[model samples]
Target: MPHDDVTTPSVTTEQNNQEVLDVFGKHRDLASLPVTENDMPIGLINRAIFMSQMSKPYHRELYNRKSCIAFMDKEPLVVDAAMSIEALTFKAVEYGEKALADGFIIARDGRFLGIGHGLQLMRVVADMQAEKNRQIMHSIDYASTIQRSMLRPSREALARTLDDAGLVWEPRDVVGGDFYHFAAFEDGWFAALADCTGHGVPGAFLTLISSSILTQAIEQRGPRDPGALLMAVNRGIKQMLGQLDGNDETPGSNDGMDAAFFWFDNASRRLAFAGAKSALFVLQPGDEEGEIVDGERMGVGYVDTDLDFTWQNRFVQTQPGSVVFVTTDGLIDQIGGPKEIAFGKRRIRETIRGSRHASAARINEAVLDQYRAWQGHHRRRDDLTFFCFRVQ
Candidate 1:
């Protein structure tokens, strides 16, 4: 809103020094007085400038009886009453130091309106910016709460579902693209970790949608076969996004997820795995190196439009003390360290081999610590998620 209420003292150009001095004495708080002819402003008289002139030797005797016009500033900052506060502020700045300290005059349709104080206008702009910042922070905090709720579960319930499991989930922002899910089915347990396409709010939305689809696939179709579960999830995602009948002519929507899913059988001591552009790491006890099993080179909904969607499952015969680790690309793609290169798959393999005999909890901690040390002062490039479990 434009401010229009200005009632600063004004004097006629013909007003004598005695009359102007009387007006100044009554106002006391005014920094400047506008000198007008009729109802239009002709000039401005700064109180300090007038007082300094009066203090000069022989000056009062020379001009005390003359018209106030002799001491008034011939050119003053005069702004329109309808001018926006932003424009008024810029106009005020053009007057240099004096306009900021002594204030300026505002007129409406060539008639004197009021005075605008520089300090008061600045305060209004500052308050408005502060309020906007507060609102944005509030919205981000609320989104963080919602994202946390989707991943958090009771410790007792999680422990009962998996024999021994550890997770490292870190988001670059309050809400991010990485997410993990675990569920117990009829024959065994199923777990998954995924990295959605972007980060922050856009990626968070995709994570929610992908997680919900994965949950429904598990509940309705069961987790007996890892490959079938992933295929069902892919179809569900394609259908939901209306990409089932997409063709080469259609522009691709760069929305999908890279994920790994595993079904653990407690009775047979076997694990079945299926992935979409992700991988699984296995470390046998006492081994100096671990093996990496790569998944199909295709993302869930990012498959080629001309080709058929087919995923293959891999089976692992787990020993009692073996460890299995699954992760999103964020862990290996992070850039830092002395070389300023990516952490890479080789570092991950070495970390797992060193902790082959350690418990899942210890291995998870060790791997995350090494990652942080390697990252050093580099900014995070993406969301990270790692899930590790010990074979019972």
Candidate 2:
């Protein structure tokens, strides 16, 4: 450690206590002094302890003839000059609480180099940590850009499948685990909204895996059945995460997603839907109540879930003005409000049902406005996603 305020205050064991006290007087900022024999360090002497004892009446006279070895610490923290700051910090704690305040001797090949100050060591460590954080944040921001480009190009394609639509995708963090999928195969199109487990980087990783796997499954299975598509995705997630039954490599790999998927068939003018612990809301023209078609209770690809567990499909016949809505738990399960209750499926149904006469954009706006107001000062619990469309 180098400091402009301090120079090496090294003394010899042959020197008397009075001479060591004179060294402290020369360097008022010095916290501790190294006591050495030849060029090798033997012990450390704290200035505070030595000064307090010497300040007593007749003590300086009594100790003037005594060797400095009498006041020097027999065992002090000694560190290699080339040692990393991180390793040295652990060594300092192990040496005892006094090691930081008293400082350590920086030695090269068992010979004293200089005194290492605790304050300077801490400053270097702090600067290193700050730089590391800045690099991580920069990488995540670039990742956010890539994720957006990957997700957003298919709005025009979806517009052809549905009459009118509005979508909301808000991650609690800047980047999150929630994502929506769109693909076209043969005559019609497919759309899905997925909420993977966890949040931030871990969750963002799943969105990539789930979205890519879902696309591959569509190509192989022909995009006619929503349930089969979901099954393939479930298996794909398990295979990707190494969560298959016989695999013991990743014992802690309990990860998956809750999703609502749709296959819009232009031939039959019908929409087939499947969900993994998800639900869809439908509000038809002139209907007093909107319908909530709940999907299977199980989620996709968790370690505990059965591989053979089948996801069932619900068919909703499309009409010219019928509206469909789907939401992830982040929206319905947000913890806020005066009572801190979940916004709930009941509120969603009420919002959509009340706005049955309005356009998809207007209804979506109303829902978001209500949701934000309800969220108030509470931190978001998870990534929020919601999507809705009017039939052609």
Candidate 3:
């Protein structure tokens, strides 16, 4: 190889082959070497074939440490530098030694330029995967922006519909897995607080799927009833699960959303609530102790219901001045303080109760303030979401 030859790998071809053998150990069944001609890969020699010659008593003296091109078998499979890590993994198992070339040749316009190690090849693959994910997340963030934009109703509409409404949401990542939405149908306002399985991109994707399904159900059913809403969403996700059969270990595949949804009829002042694994608190006016409505922590999705699932419909009567708070576990699960203790449900309750003098928005803000103070640190471990409604 020429000294200035960038096409020649920095390490000698023998060293490159030895390094691969070192990483894979003595398992010829696991690795092989590539043969090339005219700067192009031509064939492969697997470990079994290698050992057949190497084990011969006179093998070393016969070849005289010649060029690698002489040992290559006639036909081989070649992978381009642009192949995905996931794709490459499959190809490794699929094509065997043929895909395991000396090193993936880095070429431009059919001219050999450089070489990439297997792990370096995988990293290149991973970077491409991450870039694809980033593009997808960018799209969702845009959709999240649109969804959030649609959430803002006209002042007159709010006054006419919701009593007093506000929300507090902060994501630990670029995209959040927590979701909340309201829809007005025939009888009353339908609202939901949903927590999907994870935190970042995957979590965000599941929530978007859940959100789209829930929205479509509401749109079609015209906000029939909260119980019906939950049931419909459960069935929808179950159908989705049925369609996705290959990956059995996917998060939220076990069970989808942990949520609480309710239909609050302003005209009748009646509250109907349903849930999967979420909790709801109703703070009574002028009192620290409030009526707590606890629902099954089994949000919408497939569940091991034989393990005692009770989807009960509870009716509650609330008077004007009552405050209803819906929260995702992120707030309670925050690891804060010098000791890194969770903010806890107790702190959350006390904070909400103490902040009664503040506006709905202020109360939400105060909860965050209390969280930061309690944590004594920044960086909430999970996504935090809270929604408050005061019965005017």
Provide the lDDT at 233 for model 1.
75
The local lDDT score (0 to 100) that residue 177 gets in candidate 2 is 94
Each prediction's TM-score versus the true structure: 0.73, 0.91, 0.63
lDDT of 3 at 206: 72
Tell me the TM-score of model 2: 0.91
> What value of lDDT does candidate 1 attain over all alpha carbons?
0.81
- Worst 10-residue lDDT window for candidate 3 reads 1-10
What's the CA error at residue 7 for candidate 1, in Å? 3.7
Ten contiguous residues minimizing lDDT sum, candidate 1: 301-310
lDDT of 3: 0.66
Model 3 earns a TM-score of 0.63
The reply for model 3, stretches above 4 Å from the true place, is 1-160, 185-187, 219-224, 243-252, 303-310
Candidates' C-alpha lDDT: 0.81, 0.86, 0.66
Task: Give the lDDT of residue 37 in candidate 1.
Answer: 92
Task: Give the candidate order by descending lDDT.
Answer: 2, 1, 3
lDDT score, candidate 2 = 0.86
**What are the per-residue Cα lDDT tens digits for candidate 2 across 197-241?**
999988998898888898899889977788998899999999989
lDDT of 1 at 7: 55
Candidate 1 wrong stretches, greater than 4 Å? 2-123, 154-157, 242-253, 303-308
